[model samples]
Target: MICFNIIQLFVILKLCSGMRYIDLKSNFISDGVEVQHGYFMTSGKYKMFHARDPALEVIQFGETRVFPDVDYTPGTHSLFVEQFKVGDEEALSIYVFRMSVTSNSVVYKVYFHMSEFGYKLIDCAKFTELIKGKIHVSLDLSKSKSHPFFNIHTKEEHGQSTTLIEIRKSIAGFRLRNVEAKRYEFGRIMDSSFPIYMGYSKLNMFLTKATSIFIHKEDNRKYIVLRHWTKNIRFDLMTVNGILAWNAITDPEPSLLEDMHQKVFRLRDRIDGYRALNPLSTLDLAENISPELLGIEKVTGRHGGSTYALYHLEIGKEAYNKIKFVVNSEMLDMLIAKIDDRTLYAKVEVITNSQRTFLIITCLMKIDLVYETVINYYDKPNMENTSYYHVPEPYQTKIVSDMYKKYPVLINMDIDNPPSIVDHGELQYDSYILKYFRIKQEDGRGSVLSGKYAFGDIWQKDLHEIGNIPYEGNKRRLKVIAHSVNSSRIIVKPKNMEYPLLPEELQDYVIIDG
Candidate 1:
């Protein structure tokens, strides 16, 4: 309780005085990397210790401490007091400096300091001066070759850069590039769905190809505003120009910084809200969340729309075992959902927000190896045995010819014959279609017979017709090659086969070869 009181007192004092300093005992991590305790020189005294981390383009400090005898006065330090730290863990503080590549050289200045409730910008002397007899890292300016230059004004004849100055700028450029590359690398490793363009710019008039940074002064304090745009979202960070300070997102916005700030804060709040829920398990987390919480809405269809979220959930013990989920608003009118236990189960809905269909769902099971199988209920059988398409008369013969070519036993008897046109008794042509038929024998084997009498027609028809009609000559039978036992359906070959007449029967049967 005493420690808490002391901390509270310190915070009140710091706020009242507006003196920024770091508390060195707090936990500190920077850019996903842990930072060690360190000190900065102030007024020729190494009295301040700090923990620093790199965030975006600047280094933010926390856990700051000051030695005894240092006057803890607010608004007293010079803007260019060499350097200092304003890190406080419990204060949610951030303080930093920034570097930018100008046309002639790299410029350095104190950036901004920010806390949970407020932010401040410092205005100080900007410098490009190099330390004497020192060498710095070289900038690979070639990386910006593919980048275009825009609205750049360079004094070609006024002066040439000294080799020392060029070297210094190159070193600064390398540092900036390293930071950018590290950021991209982190994004790639995490497979971040949102593209992060750190210092991204199409035009590279400067070595850094930095996006435009705007400076504004309000209430005698200067602010440096930085802008970045992904395809779907925009972001901006505002910091003090000369002091190690920055305004919180809650700070009063200048009109130019309004929209992007709103968007970013909205998203940040959403994420923070979910994290605050602190589910004990994955299922609990999934069950507790809704689409709206992630900025997703009931979309019309499955086409193009902005995605609200994309994230992965771990389901197994393996280091790489995880499932990805993506939520998006679609342009389509139907709401569609598919579920695979391994990762997702999406529900699709119609434009009216009505349930349309439940797609197939697969469940992933872990055994010796992870495997997936469709649930039985979701796997419906194809309950159809009818022709899939109607063939045109002209194409029917060609189709039969192709089928016969593939299977020689499948004879094309009417390959060249077209049905003769009836001049009389057009209604009699319909009589040939039997209304119903049934097999008399219990062991109904091959095809059924449809002829009137095999007894009388045995001598009139050729041997092929008689042989084709099984059980011929005595009781006489005509094979019903294809029968609709439930309904009287007839299938007369190559001719009728092309456009087969429906069987007039009452039973359902499909011929299958043994």
Candidate 2:
């Protein structure tokens, strides 16, 4: 009976190893740096502290102040930490420390408060002293809508920097990815490592250890995949779920993959069938759609622009979802010029027939590739104008009917004439309209198409303004601007990197009084 109790006690101790700590004072040392008056816990408690770095003696002169309870529940894996006040001034004078713990590491995101006292001490070197390393800051002030963001990097390895905290508009978000302690040439000790590779869906998650499973989210769709990589070899394949049990297999069976893929196809069929039975006006469907259904198998080739990369995925026979990834290289160059590390603009799009497209995301891909935050193109109205007009003759009607046969019809206008929708002056037509364009490329100063085109043999080549009535002093000017057959989204590489793709009000004239 004593031995049995002892065994049970040992099991309890093992289970209770992960304990929570708060309000504990410890002038403890970690990685050879002194941490004072902060919380402490067991070996694997993922230590998070909320005390003023006593080493920050320059600004520590004030009345002793306590902080709110650190509301962190280990079971739920919550990411909530309170701030500690230093000065007896306003709330802005307090130091907000948001610490995040993953499977392998603990990250401290220290923000020098937004108060008058805190704002004055925004010095890069001084802030580093408050922490425990020689840190570098990257300030991105490119977007006018959003304020500058500071990326604090730990300069640990000789001539190498690893990001620790990202301070955006006063909130500090910590990321501990591949951090290793080392001494720099100037005797400054800090954390450094290779740039972390975080996928689209993984933005909501933080992993300290190298992850074999990754979740990718695009266009309101979520997909799970298994990926493994070494110095020279890499393997990536889609999976149903991010289950560790399935990942434990040394090698997945071909039959297992085939069965899983067939099941995914069946799921897509069920979703398509449901949509057909109950059609909706909004593109945001009611049914939950998995990204695994419309998965991007591979990247085909490069599009016209230097920054744009094209990827292909098979939706169905004769139907495709051509995806385009736009990376602003010019802006990246400017960022490189300004700071050692620059923020990159990475956007993804899904293009189908007849300008039926979706803007998946317009986000900032960090230079380290550790994080990506979606850019909300401020609250603007859905500026889209759609109209329907009938074709006069059998020839034109036949041409329109062929395109209509390829896709579902929408009788929105209540007109005998099938309507054509125009977004920002660009005419949207079906895949059958592909015969109306001719693909070409630029040769010298005057060029036809920067990319591929498809033209009908019946029409004569002429320059014409496609959109609306322009205000010409006394005359109307008809000029060919650009054309794309495969992609509905316009691709324009601006010489000035600061130019934004703001929505322009269409100068369209629609006759309502028929």
Against the hidden true structure, what lDDT does model 1 obtain? Answer: 0.24
CA lDDT, every model vs. true structure: 0.24, 0.25
Give, for candidate 2, the lowest lDDT window spanning 10 residues. Answer: 181-190
lDDT of 2 by residue, 1-514 (tens): 4454643443343236433222212222112121211111111111122222221111121221222222433233222232233333211112333333433122332233335433333443443333342121211111112111223334345443333333332333333221221111111011111111122111111121211333333443333333222211112222422211111112233422333334434443553444322111111111123222223322212122211212223223113222222221212111111111232332233322333322233344454657555321111122243221222355454543543343321111111211122122223223211111112243121222332322101112222222221111112233223322233222222223332323353112221111
Off by over 4 Å in 1: 1-194, 197-261, 276-321, 324-361, 367-514
TM-score per model over all chains = 0.19, 0.19
Identify the candidate with maximal lDDT. Answer: 2
lDDT for 174 (candidate 2): 33
Stretches of model 2 off by over 4 angstroms after superposition: 1-203, 206-311, 314-514
